[model samples]
Target: MTEEIEQFETVLGFQIPEPLRTVHNVHRWTRLGNSDEESIRSIIARYIEYRRAIGTDDLDLLRTFRNNGNVECIIQYLRQSIRPMVVNTLDNSVVLICQPGGTDFHALASLFTSRQLIMFYAMLGEYFFQQVITQEEISGRESGVTIVYDLENFKITDYLNPYSPIMQIFRIGIALLQEYYLELLRNLLVINSGPIVRVFLQLAKVILLPKAFEKIRIISSSNMKERLLELVSSAALPSAYGGCWTEVDVENVNPLTCCTIRRPIEGKAPPCNIEAAEHVNLSAGKSYSAKISATKGQTLRWIVKTSGKTEFAVTLYDSKGKGEAELLIPRLTIATPLPDKVPEVGSVECKDTGVYGLEFRNVNSSFFSLKIRYGWVLE
Candidate 1:
């Protein structure tokens, strides 16, 4: 395999980096069944060019984003703007599970440009490659990753139309994975597929390479557990999918958490002591507000869990003492906390010196008062 890689490099007149030098990595090209050396060389060249084009070739910058709070605001923004997707790495496989039906696709489209989304994905890809693929290679195991897409309730309408903004984002994500990270994928398993999912797969066929499309399997919900157990261990699989592990178990094993670094402390002694959780009882149709003064570049971080659905918003008052207000976070209904689930975590860097107001409105029509336990820190 090494000799073949050397021969390919000599013919192509380019050095293949250490990251792509493994036997399994090189074999991934042949898996495409394009036996022609010139065609394979062109594909490899294109892959390398795409990586450089996205600035993912700079490992240090990617690492900075992974371990620092510099991009914490953007990370939180992306999470709140879109449907949450969980990236779980178990052994040689990475499972990507999408939350069921919470995201507003149109709102997400208007929130960010295609370039911003691609850059975010680039960071995630680099992290997965360094943490998952590199570790596997060092252990003398095959370097390829088996990718599983758990699309139980994923809506096809948001992604099927080519003209839709969500579809545009979908294409960008798929193109990035196919063009730059194709070699890392061993096989793609898509569980909990229905008739609508089959229709979506037909669209996927048009976008994916023929060889790559052939590697996808659509498993029904009935046999999903049995089929997944063949690829993932019960210890690694989520309990929702007939496995023994809980959501917390899955979170603990994820490698991407390192990318969402917590707020840093300056000295051994705490900069500001942790505040006690403030309890608020909001009556129906009433709103609660908490104001804090902040300067530019400071981050406002909060953790809140609500007893019922509530609308939360953040406003920035101008430093000039004018009554003008800028809605930092528009009023949006927050999901009620589930048993043992993590609280809603959010953070945004202050762009101007102002008195920031955090408001919570009881959006529910029910007569019962909404209970909220929340805490905030400006760092």
Candidate 2:
């Protein structure tokens, strides 16, 4: 309210519309992650510049949202269930939600228009900036948000045709965030999928933008929850989805404040760590390799204990070039005997000694930790 346009005059090095001053809470909450007055002003200026480039004027949205305040039904949607839960991690908080089965998108869109949708995102942006981003910034690291969409019972609907109005509205909402908000979304996780998920993805591939499409992870139901556990702790997830949150969550109970995330669990059992080896985090779509010099025929023995159904390949090569060396062990995706047990081990002799290359690659899109140990011995 303190002459926001004037404050941003020099920060943005451009002229801002005077009508933007009438927007409610427009100036406030802009500095959720910023500490000083200049910092917040700079953030607003950058946002305005980006929006202008993307052909989305926030002034129009703010002007439209100022008139509608009857959000009783929208409030119900926010608190209908323990949804859109924030899972606090080392990097930042991930907004996780279990999509309601058999959704009524049409009725909801009718109740909430584009104006209301704009206000909704504004509120969410403020909350995320204040609660998650600011905290990470204070700790000397840039913050980001990961959104998880649990597609457990998603139904293939005619309402979700390629060019439907509902999908258009959804795309608009996504576009608003992508264009206006910078460096906000870290990743989008889609799990607990079924047959309908394939159809949805097929359609989405054609409609979605390249950046948004790249962020999507269509995980298998077998290892879906396990993949989510890596991004968000098990304590942050619902008990029904291998987390610690119980049926009755009291007012004081919050994953960020009260929930202590220790490890992943299934039903009433402990985590999947069969062999007590050293745990190492595996990055998705990246290959991890280690070189060990082998003299004559030193046997290379290794054992890997994974957390869940993580597809990984173990390859041992004597050299690294077109002329392939003796394949000590061909790359094979390690399979878990059962969903509960995840322990795999293999040993291959190094036929020759010139810098033997041992590579371990994560074949999945989601991150999974591995408890691995290896050694070289005389055979």
Candidate 3:
């Protein structure tokens, strides 16, 4: 070991100076079974100070040693001879509380080179690679430097490159640690546990992506509005829909008054059925040029054709139900129509609003179906 000490300076390209040499001698004596517990503990204290001087932590150094296996035997001797006494053996397992913020896997691994701890180092690597590296090619099962739990389950990541022999050695070492730990780690000390949990949770969110997007696309504003209109139209059919307007209040004013018919009866028919279907919506804004003819006893009927069932009203000028010019039609003028003038329907903005509901007369009676056409400037 002393002969190897001379070569250490040559390999490291720096002389093993005073305090460092003293610490290393004490460290070697313990490994060689020549030092007492007190002397080894003193060496640990001095080694800690030396580490602080170099501005590195245990975790950092361990990772570095793992990357470069040059000091493996020396580090292994330290782990076997000194590290066990330094640990805090808890009820469940050992807890290595790094000095406040001074503890790191690299430094710890560099100091203690036990197989159990080496496997843990691999796990720690796996955990960090899973968290920090999102690139898919770099995070695969066959990746060179790997972290393995069981045979099948492992996180293999690329450390550097295929050309670099240093990286190759590091990868082999990590793989060896993984294989060795599988056989040795009977009681698992959690390695990279936090980041692993986080990765799995993030994967769960990605798995649920399609369903989330479907909900968004279906319920968007434009689609929702169209869906609403379709539903309203479907539910608006006569057998289903009671009426367009709800009767709120009714008021009776005068008995009779002078009334005049306004607007032309513009009509239409749907594409298919023409039997009980000839519908018409009367344009209520303009006066209709209608030709009215009547007789005595041989009842006169002025039929208004429409597309569907509709509500219409009629009013007579200075006449009541049984007056001189009384309305004696098919159903005797349905409801109370406007007296003097009819409410305008077609406007500039909307399509049309006149007398809307019109249909074919079911009975083939010789009632002259008055087909009047009128137009208005849609406002």
Error of 2 at 73 (Å): 3.2
Query: Model 2: per-residue lDDT, tens digit, 68-175?
Result: 243223433432223333454634555545453445554444444333444455444434444343444345444556666666555656546635434645555555
Pairs with steric clashes in candidate 1: none
For model 3, residues 154-198, the per-residue Cα lDDT tens digits are 222221233332232233344433322221121221122233434
Q: How many backbone clashes does candidate 1 have?
A: 0
lDDT of 1 by residue, 50-108 (tens): 55544456565424653433334335432211112222334555444333233455444
**For model 1, where is the 10-residue window of minimal lDDT?**
78-87
Using lDDT as the yardstick, the better of models 1 and 3 is 1
TM-score-superior candidate, 1 or 3: 1
Alpha-carbon deviation at 356 in model 3, angstroms: 99
| Number of colliding residue pairs in model 3 | 31
Please give the lDDT score for candidate 1: 0.59
lDDT values, one for every candidate: 0.59, 0.48, 0.26
Clashes of each: 0, 0, 31
